[model samples]
Target: MLGADFYMPTRVFFGENALQRGKEMLLKAGHHAFIVTGKSSAKKCGALDEVTTLLQEGGIPFTVFDGVTENPPLLTCFEAGAKAAACGADFVIGIGGGSPLDAAKAIAAFAANQGMAPMDIYDDAKRLCPTLPLFAIPTTAGTGSEVNPYSVLTLEGGMKKKTFKAPDSWPRAAFVDPRYAYTLPHGATVSCALDAFAHALESYLSPKSTVFSQTAAVFAAREIWDVLSAMPGEFDVEMRTRLALAATVAGMAISVTGTGFPHPLGYSLTLLDGVPHGRACAAFAADYITYNEKSDEGRALIAAFAAAIGTKPNVMKAFLPGVAEVDFSFTEAEIAERIELVAGAGNYQNSPYVISKEEMYAIYRAHFLKK
Candidate 1:
């Protein structure tokens, strides 16, 4: 067990119809609100309508700023902050996927105090002030941006994907309703589910992991691997519910322990190659774990836990999708170069073992290349 501090300040409302409490939660923050959401999916599913309606019924005046992009940009968050100020929003509401939720957090923090750019906030979180109250309603189950204090956004000038972590950024309230994710596109479902798995596994191996965080992360990994990997192409309701639950737990685990290695390296791919965060991270899990096994840390425990949950085979298959008929389309040199590039990312700062740059490069090539 490693020594670490655990801090979880967000109030969460879970399960079906959990979103109906949004009205009460918003009222606690204040009457005037600014809502942030992605432009397309939430509107199409009518999830945005439910949130807006709840605010109206509660006699809360709110304005929805639906400009969030796939990988939230620093410039967009800055603009959104200005909009919130114009609306006189006393509280900021985030009502969509992780992108929108994270955007709301940054925008809310800057709405009252223009001390920092969203990209710069990650580099210098002290610039954020304790201003406009924060609340989150997640339309998707992955990222756990609702409860966690970190927000990942794409920075301008060189396409850097940055991280923002501040105590004041954690939402005062977060509403999780599995019903909202049912309408997510198939690609998004698979990608975000994989992302949750990465969160669970990364946190499980973190040097800062405590007993509680390890248990939450491992169980979340097991549950998600069992549910999402086993679900048929049609995406059954029961399976989706189980996946959603697993995502929430994984999010909670990362909130305390934090993730390592694969996340930073994965962020590079998402930012540069245009791969989705979840998919890019998931692709590296097997290789990264193989590197951990060399240190003889938690290898047997991981394998046993995975098998006990009846998920080893399916998860293995799901993550290494390129092994099958799916074409990876990467040359041997390109793969190796990418591995070396990500090694310089300093992800080792959060890794359980200090991995040398060369060793990190080898790990990527080991799994990516043929046996």
Candidate 2:
């Protein structure tokens, strides 16, 4: 049995009306709220209205910063942070998908510290300053950003994605109402669900996996796999709820064990090809599984995970392309450059098996290089 050292502080509220039910707890995060979100999703899903109404009822003053973009640039976070500070936001509420949720965490850091440069947020030393209290209201079923401390931001100068996490970056509470995800289009639904799948898969295969994290990973992976396997033409409330719970559980798994190579390996695709974050990470899932299968312990782990999900590894591998957009082609030069860019990421070290650059290149070539 693997030793456990789990520490998830985020109080997760799941089900149909989680936001409404958790309103009293949510209001306790702070006196003034900085609500960070994208322009449309939150409003469309009625989450923004719900949150604002709650604030009004609580007599809490709030500011809305609706500029978080996909991949959430560092500059945008800083700008939002400045606005949050100016408004005297004592706590932060992140709405929408992963981008806004991640941006909210960075904004909280910046707002609390005030005057720190954009890049300074990534510095480990800067973690000495406490971030403002954060509450997450996810509008989608993927990314599970509400439960994790990690905030992936697009750094300056190259559009590269980098992640930073501090102890206080975890949201104080997460209102994971699945009703908000019902408005998601088919493509967005697929992308987000696949991202959750990747998170669970990678966390299960990570060398850092503890018994607790592995259990969570298995549960999450199975739930997501069952939902995706059904391939619902339109996700009803039930489907959305399952995915939302799975994504949140997967987030918890990664929060403990971190992730394996697929996450970092997928980043170049997101930056260079504009692939959605989840689809990008999942594009490499098959290759990641195959690489890990080379080791005895890895093979055993994969078998266990496969058993938990009630499917064979090859079956899962073959099913990925149907649910994930994985056929994007790249040139040989581009593939080589992409490999070199992510080769140094610490994520690779977390893999169950040591991955070599040659193996990484081979995987890239097989999936993406133009023939």
TM-score: which candidate is best? 2
Instruction: Name the lDDT value of residue 333 in candidate 1.
Output: 75
Superposition error at 319 for model 2 (Å): 1.0
Give model 1 RMSD, 1 decimal: 3.1
Question: How many residue-pair clashes does candidate 1 contain?
Answer: 0
Provide C-alpha RMSD values for all models, in order.
3.1, 1.2
Which candidate comes out best when scored by lDDT?
2
**Relative to the unseen true structure, what is the C-alpha lDDT of residue 296 in candidate 1, on a scale of 0 to 100?**
54
TM-scores vs. true structure, each candidate: 0.88, 0.97
Screening candidate 2 with a backbone cut-off below 3 angstroms (N, C-alpha, C), the clashing residue pairs are: none
After superposition, the stretches of candidate 1 with alpha carbons farther than 4 Å from their true spots are 1-5, 115-120, 123-128, 311-346, 363-371
lDDT of 1 at 93: 84
